[model samples]
Target: MPRLQGVDIPTDRPTAVSLTYLYGVGPKTARELCLKAGVDPVARARELTEDEVARLAALLDKDYTVEGQLRRQVTQNISRLRDIACYRGIRHRRGLPVRGQRTKTNARTRKGPKKTVAGKKGVKDLR
Candidate 1:
């Protein structure tokens, strides 16, 4: 196993495909990182030398706000919404659908499992 950017990379898979396991890295970003670090995209992660891993990490650190930084930015955005008490923030706080999707029928995944309440006489039950 080779470690890059504090992540243990799978050596058995192609570098380009395997590097996606790292936070904030996708296929396209992995390819670009490999190119910038002078590593072959098709090379196995385990086969990389220490210098290669160091170079790759350095390159990514220099050029990208990845992993913790990116996660923090997203958290900050949500925090700002909460601070402002916006409608979207309230929706997020309630853990309900925020995009105006029809919740009367669908959105069970967000709303959790349906709980049926007993209906009054002559009233149809709505699940």
Candidate 2:
């Protein structure tokens, strides 16, 4: 494992792929970082020299908001939305999908297990 920006990137994968382990960094961003840092994207993480790792870390710290900072920024944005009572904010506050995903069917991950309600008549038997 190679530690970069407080995260340990997997040594088994290519540098580009391993860099994606950092928060807010994806394959595209990782490739861009490698390009800017003059690192070989296809190189394995363990194969990187100290100077190369230093360059990668410097580029990320100087030009990108990632890891804890990115997470905090996102949470703050969500909280701002919630405080403003926006539609998306309400969804977050209510623990529902926020991106116009239909809740009538496949929102189980957000809605959690169905809460069974006792019915007055034959509704229970319908199950």
Candidate 3:
């Protein structure tokens, strides 16, 4: 495993693909990073020299917020939204879909399991 931005990238994979193991980096970003760092995108991570690893790590640290830092930034954004009490923030506060998806039917993921309530008993039942 190759460590980049505190994440373990699989050594068997190409550097381009392995870079995506870091949070906030997708395939496109990975390729771009490899190009910027002068690393061979197709080369396996295990084949990288120490100098190459140092260059890649430096490039990422200088230009990107990833891993735990990225996660904290995202959580802070959400918390800020909630503190403002906007519609989307309210949705987040309620744990409902934030993008205006119809909750009346198919929001099971956010709404969780249905809670059944017993119907009112009728007078006829006493007869």
| lDDT tens per residue, model 1, 42-95 | 988878888988898898789887777888998899888878999988887777
lDDT score for residue 60 of model 1: 75
Badly placed stretches (over 4 Å) of model 3 are: 106-127
What TM-score goes with each of the models?
0.78, 0.85, 0.80
| Ranking according to TM-score, highest score first | 2, 3, 1
Structure candidate 3, residue pairs in collision: none
Clashes (N, CA, C under 3 Å) per candidate: 1, 0, 0
- Model 1: runs farther than 4 Å from truth? 105-108, 111-127
Best by lDDT: 2
Candidate with the larger TM-score of 1 and 3: 3
TM-score of 2: 0.85
Order the candidate numbers by lDDT, best to worst: 2, 3, 1
Range of the 10 consecutive residues with the lowest summed lDDT in candidate 2: 118-127
The C-alpha lDDT values of all candidates are 0.84, 0.91, 0.89
What is residue 123's positional error in candidate 1, in angstroms? 17
lDDT of 3 by residue, 24-56 (tens): 999999999999999999999999999999999
